[model samples]
Target: MTIHTTSSCTAFEGVRRIASGALRDVAAAVKRAHDRAGGEPILVFDDATSSPIEFDLRGGVDDVLARLADAAANGAGAAGQDDEPAAARSRGRPKLGVIAREVTLLPRHWEWLNAQPGGASVALRKLVDAARLARADNERVRLAQEAVYRFMTAMGGNLPDYEEATRALYANDRARFEQMIAGWPGDIREHAAKLAAAAFCEVT
Candidate 1:
């Protein structure tokens, strides 16, 4: 998936952190690091998603930054969208970026939605917005868990107690999770906690 984020990103040369900051700046740093032979492979991850960002750093710094800008401008919209055919979904409001994808529902569900004042589409939108607001805290925790897990798979896969640490992470036992990774490299351990800040929140 083509992803874009304005937030910060972090890069690691094997287990050693080499850079962390704005995406473009980090890319430049990675290029410089790659030039210094005898260094470990570099992986740059988006702070928002923990996914390794792919950008061509082949040419000069300016060239890399230019390509990054081009990417953002043409960012393949958002990821994880339904793969419905273009003809199936309607362009309700092209200017507002409103895409109308197919929604499957039972007969009774459709009846209830159509009965609303503004009809099915409006009713569905309102219901979605309300549900998102109500589940904000739960959503935050879920995203954090995903972020932490993604990073762990990439960076801590071979670490001692990796399996046990994963179990504690998903179990929401913050204490146990910390203990599982206590012997990990300082940078890796600290980063895991940083990524999980929200995952361990006391959700209600």
Candidate 2:
């Protein structure tokens, strides 16, 4: 999408009033002319500093379109326009190689996780991946929580009641909840801890 910007001046009035959806190149050129003459483009929205669309005014329609095509392909902006800063560059979906924030599990939590079929490291990764997938699907954190309940129902799991565990955690009595969970089956205990950690943030 070629976003063209132009000054709100009388000389470039024709550029500003171009046919809807057409003449973006002319608009861009006019804006460039205005900029060269030392005026800033007027943003249409009260909340926006710049137009949602940007335009490049370096040449004729074909030339501008060619440039726009190239930019669209390569994700570049206008010729003299500043490249997005490092902070603003990473927009859209999260990157695969980026480091995610770390959440520390208590010793008992680790012990519980270790008792799972895949052990602590694998289990934690699985939990994180599951949470990410749920978030992507727009699943409510509470709704995504059915996984914890399911895990608890498995054989040799420690948790006797998913609702009670969630209630204690939601109430902020972490110590009491952890104590209640310590005696459950190992897998249930591990799963509850994961749920608690995930739900804790949503609740607060």
Candidate 3:
């Protein structure tokens, strides 16, 4: 199994966003900025999730690149073929970390579930998977909105029309949000727009 990790990150020096891209790329940019002015505080945030990214900053850009490559290789090698006995694996669920918990349901509901082709567990899993698929788009939009809100709260709280911009953001009013943030500093406005891009696109 191949494990994929997020690639997007943004580096900010004070309120100015210096770079935005893959983790390694942003790390490189941060190094350059740090070299130009020693001791200036720099922060890197995951662009998609609006969370801080921490990495070893003791070395140079080349070191950071090597570490990133090593991480990628390790992730790929982490999940190899399982060597457990087939019969033992088949005896119960495939060690998917399933937990047994008591659930209370009406007699009619239990009856309906028990009558399903694969019984209750399989039927419930299928139903859940189907529901997740159906709601995938909405879930994506909601998460994007939440990420944007988090970034805005951390970085743009003091900007003009902050409250109105937040209201428009939650209201899914793209035009209004854009108008409200029009007077913001270029860097802040651009970063906020980038964070909210997906959420705003879902407004239609």
**TM of each candidate vs. truth:** 0.69, 0.25, 0.66
Quality of model 1 by C-alpha lDDT: 0.85
Each candidate's number of clashing pairs is 0, 8, 0
lDDT of 1 by residue, 1-204 (tens): 244665789999889888889988888898888878898988888887797876687788888788887777666454435679889976675577689788899999999999999999999889999888769978888889999999999999999988898899888999999999999988888889898878997664
Task: Write model 3 residue lDDT over 28-59, tens digit each, in one string.
Answer: 88877887855457877778888777666558
Top model by TM-score, which number? 1
On lDDT, the candidate that comes out on top is 1
Assess each prediction's global lDDT (C-alpha) against the native: 0.85, 0.49, 0.80
As for TM-score, the candidate ahead, 1 or 3, is: 1
Give residue 139's error in model 3 in angstroms. 0.7
Ranking by TM-score: 1, 3, 2
Sorted by lDDT (best first), the order is: 1, 3, 2
- The deviation in Å at residue 130 for candidate 1 is 9.4
lDDT accuracy of residue 197 in candidate 3:
82
